[model samples]
Target: MIEQFFPELKRYAEDFVASYGYTAIFLISFTESIIQPIPPYPFIVSAPFFKLNVYMAGIVALLGNLLGALAAYYSASFLGETFVKRLLGEKLYLKGESLFNKYGFFAVLIGEPYKLVCWLSGIFKMPPLVFLIASFIARSIRIGAFVFFGNFLEKFIS
Candidate 1:
């Protein structure tokens, strides 16, 4: 489905990962976490196909994702609750608020994909160091899985 809609993007991701190596993975990971719709999974998964070192790729990607997440976190922090409330509206914002209030740190760690969790964490003013730690752990696991699957796919094909 993605290929059908965005063949050029797919090709660009492939070519970028192939040519730029870990740097590509880092940049993609960063962009994806911040605002880009394309996830970094494809880049991580295709690293082996490009004959790039999967471990390095994963680490660099993790770093990028952390940086991006931090950017999101800080951006939301700067924007404050009024902006988020206006953006999300009353009902949705309340739901997010309820979840974050209940789950706290785990909300950010577990719901990394939601992206809103990161923003909400900042909006609610979760401690910066705590947010960083939880985000790092979550992103590490996620990136590891993508790298593992990429290597697994490579070996399967070979």
Candidate 2:
């Protein structure tokens, strides 16, 4: 579906990962967690194509995402709700706020649009340690699933 817009993205991601290795993975994942619109799955799946270790790629991606989430969290915390609402737009901010209000920590744990949840967590003053632990677990499971899926694809193709 994304290829309809970015026809060369897959190829570009493959080449980028091949050339830059884990650094490429980290940067891709980092920007994705913030506002890049592109998901890191393609770059992560390309790891095996470049003979990079998928597990390590997943770890690097997880770390990058965690850092990016933290950056967003802190930015929202420091910038205040009005600024965050402007940044995220009123509709999205309201939706995120509703989810945070209703689900609390579970919103961060289970929300699909994680960036919003991360920002809401900070804006709502979720405990830092709690946020960290939840994000770590959620991101690990998410990245681990992608890594294993990539491994499966690699083996299937081989």
Candidate 3:
């Protein structure tokens, strides 16, 4: 099928990750952290397969994801509770608020390492400094995971 008509497509996928690697990684991390639908960790993991391309992929993922988190945070902060309640529905708004209070930025710490959690932490009105610190800690953990699992990740698939 694909290979028969365009055998090079497969090879392209490999180079594609390397060639446009930074842009794609950043887009996935940053956008997904906001209202977009991509996940962050997978891209970082996917990048290591190319070996030389891996470090750049990881960096792109981190910056993009952090940018996405900032977007989510600002969106939530400026939107206000009343607006959030109207958009998210009272039930979710209440739950989010509770979670925000219960975990503080640490809650985001758990999820932000992935992407969406970073923004959600911001939205819940967690302290800015806390969010920043927690995000950094979580991201560091995630980055470390990438490095530790680099070899294994080459063949990772879901």
Q: Candidate 3: where are CA atoms >4 Å away?
A: 1-19, 48-52, 111-116, 152-158
Winner of 1 and 2 under TM-score: 2
Alpha-carbon shift of residue 64 in model 1 (angstroms): 0.4
Q: Which ten residues in a row have the lowest lDDT in candidate 3?
A: 111-120
* Clashing residue pairs, backbone N/CA/C < 3 A, model 3: 30-64
Candidates' lDDT values, in order?
0.81, 0.82, 0.64
Candidate 2 RMSD to the real structure: 1.9
Q: Which candidate model has the greater lDDT, 2 or 3?
A: 2
Counting clashing residue pairs in each candidate, in order, gives: 0, 0, 1
**Candidate No. with top TM-score:** 2
Query: What is the per-residue lDDT of model 1 for residues 19-111, given as tens digits with 9 covering 90 to 100?
Result: 888888888888777666667777778777888767778889888988888887888889888887876678877988898889998987887
Against the true structure, whose lDDT is highest?
Answer: 2
- Winner on TM-score between 1 and 3 is 1
Please, what are the lDDT tens digits per residue for candidate 2 over residues 38-141?
Answer: 66776666677878888888989999999988888898899999998998899988888788889888888898777777788889999988888889988898
RMSD of each: 2.4, 1.9, 6.6
Task: Name the lDDT of candidate 2.
Answer: 0.82
Report lDDT (Cα) of residue 118, candidate 1.
71
TM-scores vs. true structure, each candidate: 0.84, 0.89, 0.71
